[model samples]
Target chain A: MADVAQQILLSEIAFSYRSQNARVLDIDRLSIDAGEQVAFIGATGAGKTTLLRLIDGRLFGWTGRAEVLGRTLSPRRAAPRNWNANIGFVFQEYALIERSTVYQNVRNGRLGRTHSALSLVGLFSDRDETAVTEAINDVGLSDLADQRVDQLSGGQRQRVAVARCLAQEPKVLIADEPVSSLDPTSAEKVLDLVRACAEARGATLLISSHQPKLVAQYVDRVVGLKEGQIAFDTPAGAVTPEQLGSLYGWHVADTAARSA
Target chain B: MTSEQRISQQRRRVADWSGFMVTVTVGVLVVWAWVATDIDTGRLADSGGRIGAFLGRMFPPDWSVLPTVIDGSLETFHIALLGTIASIVLSLVLGVLAARTVTPPFIHMPLKWLLAAIRAIPLILVAMLMVGAVGLGPLPGILAIAFHSTGMLAKFYAEAIEGIPAGSLAALDSAGATWLQKLRFGAWPLIAPDLVRDTLFRFELNIRESLVLGLVGAGGIGFYIQTYVRTFQYDKAATLTIVVVIFVVLIELVNHVVRAALK
Candidate 1:
């Protein structure tokens, strides 16, 4: 079902806050083909998140000709009902319902596809339940499916977030700094689970991160952002210390020394 | 010492003086309140002996009116329970509107102020109004408690809603959740326990308030207590008081166990 049109295309995109004097994001052009796993990496304020948010359809009031999933995209967070069915977003904090079980959190991912009345009453169809169970198994949390999210460990909670997105059966999956808040081992594990799941589903995965080394192995291409603009878009293997130094405002010699 | 240190010391002295001034102002306000209310310390001292004599008469504990005491206590409990249920139902709706995170300022501000305005009037005052409007019965007392408690519970609920991570709301919002769906998935889980605890706490307070509403002819234990007191039936009033104390203890024990379970 992959169309010839790019999965994501933003041309002459510029977003600014009306309250602020300067624009936070100003991208000349960017495009991602269907099923491409791309990583956006840069310093803290480099608009990596802004770019992902735009494609996720959670941002508004942008000057751009944006087309996502082969349709003209609005800058607003919503369009026609179910416009966001194909896009799923995973927040940095896992964002699993602390008071709810892993099963419910994962099941909620398919909410957009279901009848609103069913979800309003906290019910899910058998089809939704199957997808949820499959995703829970995919994330290796099937044993903890009935367990409350608050009862789980941090890494386990992050896995629940990944499972939630996977259960959505989305065509485009966006994860914003997914591993930034986890311990090193947990971070690696979450990344592995998310990367493996996205690949299996053949979803267009867009991960934003400041840790280049962590994301390099997961993505085929890396787009380096500098002050709200893409400084470089290259194959992940082609990224080097020099480009990294420029993205994070590190001196060339300092980055080289660290690498050496 | 550095000039900065000397300046810091001077600022500390000024802050201490300001704190002292605030204490003095509070003291003055207290004095003003006592004066305006015409609280007679002499009368309080004079009543000490009478209070002792009254307690002396109650040492044998009259068990004859136990049934009446129990009946009044049950009525009070019923009123409190019904009011609590109604308050929680209404607060759940109003609280979402009061929360600034999900609601726009236009809606949030007015709802917040309305809750505050409702809360400004004491439950007993509301009960009196209800009694006046709807005849003397438990219905008026229950309605009074529900109306007043709605404001109190809504404030607590709104705070609980606002206290959780704002990012959680964004997570659900990004999922293309409807407003009700966002509340179900985002807000409900975060605030459910707190809302329950607050409701229990309000119910405990409502029990006490319901009795007072009864004193104002709103119908409950307070009506019996008022009748006993007016007719110098101190032993019966004392029995009713004992029942109320025991009832409150029971409610607190339930609250403690329920709160622990929530944890």
Candidate 2:
């Protein structure tokens, strides 16, 4: 177990955007193995996003021994400004450039690895073209690759975002509410693509979702979060309805009680 | 019954009081402005006959100097075009420097203040200074318009750039894109249309300012108009006035179409 690299190892991590006392995330211990697909399950304001942001280095003041992809985070200094070449973040809002073509949006995923001149001038090499084509193909968007991202449906746009992530060829992929914006049918299709793509690349996938059952069959593990701490970490198949009810305590005790 | 009688009635009373306060404040401000400007109906009644006499003199506009006025009008248009182009190019550069998303406060704050300082100086005053420096011509007018417009355009560009949401910006950052790359992909798409619209507006505004500068001897249609009126050639001045009005109306129509197409 120790031989293989730990993709994420955050312990006793605490952070707050407002003040030292008003902590938003206070995870005591969290770990993910290489190539592990883990889904974080929590209601709104339950530190799931804060945890993801902490790993992504979007949030700072990590009060404890927090390390990501083997790099140790420091309390005295903020996280180092390095290119996150091996990590992919799928934002909930689809975040694709509205005016840019699907190919152009997906090509942005390769920006981390592409030469500055190549990316800015948009003079993609044969290799760059191949990568972009492959990513578009991966997301099943080849027929509409020339279309602008804003022209696509909500589901198609999410797929484009996933394609952009796949194009990055990241070793660790973190998706924040990847399916929340999609319709029921679209959400299923998007999740399948995300799962299949992650498996093909063997990337360590960490996704956060408010709905537990929505992602139960897709992710191998479900980590429940409450308030600012980890409430439970269990295999996806084993998460009981009661556990989900307790996790989403924002529904209040009445709702949880009624559900029980 | 209690909700209506006590709560709703109290809310209505509060709203009426606030409305009355706003009305009285506006009334006071308007009265003060009227007093300060010495505006009186009695004075307007006294001046009506003289105003009518002046209007009568402006009629039967002389057409002999039409060619000279045309030359001056073209110069004004050219000044506005050249100045707008120069200012827009400079705005694109300085706007990026001043953007909060792109620049740290160390750079952004200083650039913002400098732009504000540039805007604080009246364009007419700048034109006068340039006229003195360059020794009288539309060159000074062009330079003055460009100088004043740079401050305005850069500020608007910064606002447009800042209005872009953070989610897309964060996506670009996480993808290992550099600051310049992020701006190119993230900021440019959202801001380009607005920047184009703002450039058109500045051009229109600069055209009017160019005419004003011409009155001060910076050399445009207004220069001819000022010279004509001073020499008691009201007819030629009236002709220039008609031409200027027509030119401005045409430009405004073009501006409307371009802005609509951009949207």
Candidate 3:
């Protein structure tokens, strides 16, 4: 088994957009352990997604360090060709390339591991074809594999996105609001899929969502953020209703009143 | 209401319609006046007989000239094909430079202006200029067609790149794809169909442009037309016109097949 104590670490990271004169992200220190399911909950514009981008090394112009699987993040550093081979990301919008077929979209996850220029020029590899089909099957989207992504429903597209990540066979899965755009049933099913996939692969799961109830039910740990800063980092069962309110700027009474 | 009141309302509505008609008549008259200054309508009417006489002489299209035009028509097709291929290649590079997503505004703005300037020159004039420099035949025609095609293809390619869905790019970036990888995976697949369609359309346009280029001593069926017309061989000119039409129809059929295959 992979060591559960091994962690992805981000230290003293700060980033700002060059086009805009605002500090979009700031983090002093954060660590996510392997095989742990961590959820980030915060209000809109709290930089939840930005932090995720930073960890993935998508956002540059940042100070300090981000180390994933012990590799320090740097633009000059070629991400281990296999870096994404072991790290899967589910975008908030379920960013499946709309023009491509479901099989092609899922197959993209294997890009990091595929043989180089020669294979691409020849345009056929049995291994890639099999992996892509298996991923579609895993997501229960076998019937829709040949369909264009734009033709799928919102929920179906989201499943395709998840299948893409699954195809990567990652050891760390990062999903930003994987279910926010989904209906309640779809949302539950997506969350269930993410949890089951992470547990099965023994991968650390870091998912961000605004819904506290879903997080509490599905995640093993919750990392709450307020104003781009961590407010609570605790086991899911230990996160009180007061803590959830503070994270979202809602009072417990208001939430309870609304619920009643 | 009384009949008198109803008649008065009808008269007001007729006045409104007459007012609108007067305004439209005045607008038409102004435009007609502007157009009539350089145009001799009386002379045009008088020359109708001469035009009809010329048309009558163009009949009995000399079928013997058909074999001669086959060679010139093939040359025109070659010019269009080579020009379109060259233009598509050059434009792809320039288009990437002009795309705002790939290049900063500082780079994109100047490159866009250069393309605009290139497009400003008429293709016939371009062929004439090349004739002055390179001297006659298909080379000048190819160069002219290529220059015009570059402007059009570059503009279309840049727009196609810009229209790609943002989600795929964001996803690729998050996955740590390099700029080249992002272009290969995220950008190209989305824009390829549009690019292919635009290329086919440009090829169609280039065939017509190549015929015009032949006016400036560039080798094409237009060269044959010029020769036949200068020698007052109306029958031969008519034969060349028919040949050009046939070539265009055949090319259009090929384009349809290529487009279908690409789709």
Worst 10 residues of 3 chain A by lDDT: A115-124
Candidate order by DockQ, highest to lowest?
Answer: 1, 2, 3
lDDT of 3 at A138: 76
- Give DockQ per model, in order: 0.56, 0.54, 0.35
What is the number of backbone collisions in each predicted candidate, taken in the order shown? 0, 0, 0
lDDT of every model, 2 decimals: 0.86, 0.85, 0.83
Residue-level lDDT for A18 in candidate 3: 80
Please give, for every candidate in the order listed, the TM-score of chain B alone compared with the true chain B. Answer: 0.88, 0.86, 0.83
Q: Which stretches of candidate 2 lie over 4 Å from their true place?
A: A63-67, A70-83, A250-260, B1-64, B89-121, B132-135
Q: For every candidate, how close is chain A to the native chain A in TM-score?
A: 0.95, 0.91, 0.91
Lowest summed lDDT across 10 adjacent residues in model 3 chain B is found at: B172-181
Error of 3 at A125 (Å): 5.7
Which consecutive 10 residues in model 1 chain A have the weakest lDDT in total?
Answer: A76-85
User: What is candidate 3's lDDT per residue for A23-44, written digit by digit as tens?
Assistant: 6666788888778789899999
The candidate scoring highest on DockQ is 1
Residue A77 displacement in candidate 2 (angstroms): 8.1
Q: Which scores greater on lDDT, model 2 or model 3?
A: 2
- Model 2 sits at an interface RMSD, in angstroms, of 1.9
